[model samples]
Target: MGLSLRTSRFRGAVYFGSKNLLPRNLETMKTRKFLGISLSLIIINLAAIMERADENLLPAVYKEVSEAFSAGPSDLGYLTFVRNFVQGLASPVAGILAINYDRPTVLAIGTLCWALSTAAVGASKYFLQVAFWRAVNGFGLAIVIPALQSFIADSYKDGVRGAGFGFLNLVGTVGGIGGGAIATVMAGNDFWGVPGWRCAFIMMATLSCLIGFLVFQFVVDPRRISTDHDTGKISNREKLIDKSNTSSVTVWSESLAAMKSVMKVQTFQFIVLQGLVGSIPWTAIVFFTFWFELIGFDHNGAATLVSLFAAGCALGSFLGGVIADRLSQIYPHSGRIMCAQFSSFMGIPFSLFLLRVIPQNVSSYYIFAVTLFIMGLTISWCATATNGPMFAEVVPANHRTMIYAFDRAFEVSFSSFAAPVVGILSEKIYGYDPKSVDPLLGSTREAFALSRGLLAMMVVPFGLCSLFYTPLYWTFKQDRENARTASIKETEML
Candidate 1:
């Protein structure tokens, strides 16, 4: 059982039990490393960063976008609404593709879609054109995200899956911060006779295309490489498929079966239910930078505040996963659920403090910074600490992509409404006058109104999200046991 010196250099192939089958050219380079992490993981993580950067590009420059399009809060909200609605509705494409193709190929296709769309959004001459491109952007994300999630699920074992997802999120958040910061700083200036925001999008698209290429060429599919530990041989189930031999009808039927299997899990159902409510607050927070700008903070200041909060969330994601991993070891059945509820409950108090208690003025910048940072650190744990790892536990390995896809489909489709709702409440109920907004000075009254709209969407949802996790404590144990039993039968049959 001991690995020899030759095995160490090709650790990836050895770990997956495919060392002898590796291509002759790649024998000495079976696994590559960067800063102690696997090259495959690094590539995928970089892809995640680019995806997030592309997503945050528009939101960071909402003020400039509004000015360029002669739009209001409602129009801005509608842009986010359209993107998320399409992303949610189209998420199943990822699951379907995963059934018939390698995830790296699926990911490459998605990256191309989004890259093209991002460039189109930058070049668009009309608001409608931008909207169309944004929809395309959403479709791209719908394809990429689920594939990425399932890839990580297969790469990490059950015990460390939370940390895997958290590490991904943490790295992805860096791209988001960079995208938002660059867009915000550049919105006031132009590059080569083009608007700075447009330039930002174009640059991101170029970078994305390169990353997509790297992913397609370098990242191996973990599921395809797995072997039977007891026999020290290939598992019949993990053989690489002959793509030409598979039919469309067969793929569809298999996909449908996976969907049904995932849908039957009570744990998945509860998690999706919580996600529907929990996602609303995040959807509404797209207006955070815009609100800060309206409160008279300049571009740099607004970006700084948002970045601080994002940095906290980034670190907190990793911390939460580590904590939940340790807790799950101790309390197996209920520890993750407890962590999730506590995280969700923290959202309510923080939403109040950030949107209501903090004075809506530039002078209170430090107060808002500290509060937002701490709030983000505490409230960002639910997904990494519980939902993702729990989803993996309660479903068969093959159904992982389907479960995550459906979760996004349900949660985002419903939560997509929050953006427009916030805009409506701000304009209709709180009396925000978009035309009266001074581009340079900013309107305190408008900031206050936007803050009110945010509160309406955030507080009640946080409480409900917390309450929804209660059922998972009861359902998770049974579902997890069933999954394990099924997996054992599957292995025996293979």
Candidate 2:
């Protein structure tokens, strides 16, 4: 017999089976739907993983790129900044798109943007060409964060969402490490008719495009709702429905109103503020490989060290998710905020260790590697597991994407300036203008200067995040309950 379709508006139920679903039949159908959801998770994440690797790929390979483009450290820094600036600028656009259209469509577009632009960068002979392509690449990278994050937030409730997000971060961060290794190994070798680095970009771009196609064809969006005001419970595994009333609202006014309302939340504002500071350290990661090359290590060695940092980042992020998830189970009210505060406070020492500790020679590489790893771990807990859920819990699924979008935009727009600033600091420490580093290039002095500048910038964010996170403990509970109530009412209105 064919499966039947049943839906109820008032009761809020949808069934795609016969009037009576036999226990065995229901079990099999449930199994099949679960499999579909699993496949969707796999494909979307695979596309995301490749996108992350592509983002990491350029920075990892930037050493050779610098040589090829005849660019100085600051010029290379500007390239990184340019891409992120574009990403920041495009974040709102991506959020708006996500809100207006379906997630998969937006994701597909972003995937193609990076793949094509990265390919263009691979083929470019001019610095401007490379810069232009990198900017496009940043636009692609922008949606990967907010879209996927919104999906996670939309799909799961607060109690279980951390683990889902943590896993997402784990895989993505590992992809970052893998991207570095791939770029490093391929930077100098020849491939099927292309230079090694070029081959790296082309191959990744090709694979991502294929994943993009799969996203358009197969990825199923989970349920997005204004929320049920009465029940305060929504199932992650529930089949999605477009609540008709909400769907009929004028998109522009409603979306703007939703955006304005979330921005007014004090906790949301604090989280966005913390994001500006937290994102600065990532600039170090982007520049870390370049610094390694300048310090006398070859390309492969530097990549390996950076990978170590990535691994630490992945491990820490995974642990954060696990810890926070556990906390949610044990302490429903303040677990997430508490974990976030702890992570923020813990970052201070790690930042100091990685930046303040001097590397005298190549033998001292492991010291920096270990410190960087610990630093990576310390840095991830807040963003990966805590932040997404924290913002998401207070917003309805309808506006969840923008919450993340604005947060990203807030942070990226400010953090975009970090590269030039860090470069300037490095210049002062090295005691040379951009053009005159031949003798001191890659010297211990340059490394120290770079590290000191990086360290100097990290102090404020790490210290201040704890301060910002503290207010959440006092405010998050009430805010969350209020949102929960409001989302339901909003859904009914829609």
Candidate 3:
């Protein structure tokens, strides 16, 4: 949830957005204190979940949206493209804002944007308006998400970072699971005679507004704590200000420097590449509801399966972090990469093969649910947990948000284009001439073709991602040690 929220697509609002963290031994933190902090975190997480629910709800109401606007595959592609492209570019900008300004205030603005845009989306009548509001929603997320991730990273030590992040991701997945259920329930039910899809966005808008008020009024950003001021009232500056002795530097210049510093790392380069390659398939998983429908599941059934898959992803994310932490502690240098490599390799069969080749003579719909659950579990192992925290280990604390921003920007840039590409392929290359008709509920063959083609292309990324691990084995150990040394010096200076 902290970072993997965006990477997972549907749930990308923001987590506990922060500045610099006051770190303690999170593992051994007192039980009462932990519970108190957890309560705050839950409230903050609710805002993000509310903000992101509309995007997650899209799949369940896609047909309704499509019909309402007379949308083609390309039009749907445009909607995804607008939001994701803006999100990618906006991530680094959000990081820069977090570094220079107040995080909670920034998050407030973002939350307001999401809430307003969601309401606007519900009120919108045209496809262009829908796309516009969605893009606005994404921009809001870009601001909130980077801040949240940076804060979450700051709260914990490197040793337990994976587990902490895993917990965050698990919570996010739970939110997404809930979103799917909400979408299923709301898609057809009329509220005040309004369409279900519109109702979903309106509800999200209302929720985001309520949550935003709570966040603005009560959310205490950890990064604002400072040692120099009386009662620590003076705001904490970016770590780079102290490190580079450039307190006078402009926020833009500092952001550029941070971006350059993060990009200069060899190990980080490979890590980003691995994420980039792997996310190609991951981003497309949002479309699986259509596939499940193509195979015979009703909208509710498909949404149920999608939720099941999300649950698997949540459980897997937790287990992946626990395993990654254990392995890294035991084996050191190559352990995390090894686990990732295995996960990616194992993921290929379950994710791609199962998605591509439908099971023959399936006894029941439960088979589909069960298979998707297993697929979700295996496919999600490398999605977060180990790698995100690994970024903290290898990079300077000051530059962490920038690195996250860069990864978000880069991955979203590529993934934003995927929607259009898949749409084009479905229409031009392998399109089914007649839209498939479901006896229970009618479906477009074009949509089915789009799903099929997307599934086929997804197989390639899983294979390519497996090979990215080899380069990391050589560079990771040295980089981790150097980062440790740097962290020690930085701590001493503080």
Candidate 4:
């Protein structure tokens, strides 16, 4: 009897031990999946935040440079010209690198470049030096963004891609907020009597480099790490063979052909045109923060308002993705079209109200803040929501990165030119006062007012864009139906 009891006890102990170990194994798996998702999100957010930090840093830096060197309105245009021209020029190269190299290495190099460029900006003495460094900064960002976005799209499945992108946008929004908040806080205090604005750049550069190091060390390339069957590993030789067989052309030739193909697609052409039109307001608002301060608010106040704009953009991005995803399940193309149309249509009236109707005396600051938040939400949603998905779907998976890069190149080039033109307009139309002793010393307030007023005029382009979307949607619908029919016919033949 004693032997029987001892044996039974041992058996019970083994059973319980195995049962407990099962949960531990499951928990470990869960933790790993969570970490993987979290890491990807962080990478996406970091890329966006790094680019947007330039926007947040602009106001403070502009203030410092203006005070130090007495930067005029035209000088500000030169700064924009440098930053945007570099970004536009580097986009195609970045796209090529993203497709050819390992994404992690490319991103690491980009992060390092960005960090060094930002640091150089802080250390520079002359205006031309600042412009040159800013161009380098833009070049770094040009590499980072396309690669990061392509990685995310490659990692996610279509069913949940929108939600994943929405989450990524949320993370990016948080990063932007964090960047602005940090700048605001630093600008509020003098660290060891170091200038607050200068400290902002130093801190940003340090953080960027540290994050890059972490990414280089720990962030596994999703192409290598993802276990999804769709993302099968292929040797470089296989990739090259596949490319050769698909187009019988060199990479650049293939890229150019793809561009021609996309342009021939009416939907794609319209979308690109609409994107350019919509982008003007976005670039204007981001760069005009310095003018905001010149108009009325203190540095901190302007920063806070910009932070709110970022928040609104985040919300819009999330909603836009969700709505588009759901609508695609039902109406196919209608949701995205409506989202763009409504946002642009509504933006016009709101902008006009802010510019023309609002009385200037009673805390116009809050009014502008509220208007900007709405404008940001609508504009960002319209900008990113449909275009990303359209680009992803219209182009073949292999060519998506190149097509996106090409689209970016066109949009950025035009906007780069447009930014300087806007600045010039401000100087000519609003800033110059013939009666004033210092005609060259443009009135910042009038400049901002003119900028806002000019932005409101974009309503015309927005309406034109909305009209263009109709034909684009019809063309996309036809193409989709044709593809579906062809797929069905092929399966039937099989």
Best by lDDT: 1
2 or 4, which is superior by lDDT?
A: 2
lDDT per residue, candidate 4, 1-494, as tens digits?
Answer: 89999999989989998998988886776677669767865765676676566545754445456655567545766777677778777877766665555667777888889888888877777888888998998888777776766666666665555665666676677677777767755765677877776778877898889777766766655544434223355433235435655653476675576456556656667777876766665555545455555555565676777777788888888787777777777777666677677766666776667556765432577887797788767766664457666666665454455656666777676666655665567667666321331222334456454555456435565666566666665777765454356445633542
Overall local distance difference test of candidate 3: 0.71
RMSD of each: 6.3, 6.4, 12.1, 6.3
Compare candidates 1 and 4 on TM-score and give the better one.
1
Candidate 2 residue runs with Cα over 4 Å from true position: 1-21, 192-194, 224-249, 432-441, 490-494
Model 1 sits at a Cα RMSD from the real structure of 6.3
User: What lDDT is obtained when candidate 2 is compared to the true structure?
Assistant: 0.75
- Candidate 1: the clashing residue pairs are none
Give per-residue lDDT, candidate 4, residue 486: 48
Candidate lDDT values, in order: 0.88, 0.75, 0.71, 0.65
Listed per model in order, the count of residue pairs whose N, CA or C atoms clash below 3 Å is 0, 3, 7, 0
Tens digit of lDDT per residue, candidate 1, span 273-374? Answer: 999999999999889999999999999999999999888888888889889998999999998999999998999999998998889999999999999899
1 or 3, which is superior by TM-score? 1
Q: How far is candidate 2 from the true structure (C-alpha RMSD, Å)?
A: 6.4
**lDDT-based ranking, best first?**
1, 2, 3, 4
Q: Please name the candidate that would achieve the greatest TM-score relative to the true structure.
A: 1
Report the lDDT tens digits of candidate 2 across residue range 1-494. Answer: 12232225323342433434556675665676677678778887787688778879878877677667877667777888898888888787766667667788889989988889988988999999999998988888787668888887766667777877887878887777787798888886888777798888888889889989999898876652323332356532222223323554555665677679778877788888777887776765587887776677877778888888888878888788878988878887778877887887877887776666555467878787878778778667887567888888777666787888888888987887777677777876655343433422456666667666677667777788777777777777787888889877855554
lDDT of 1 at 240: 21
How much is the lDDT of residue 46 in candidate 1? 96
Point out the worst 10-residue segment of candidate 2 by lDDT: 236-245
CA error at residue 287 for candidate 4, angstroms: 3.9
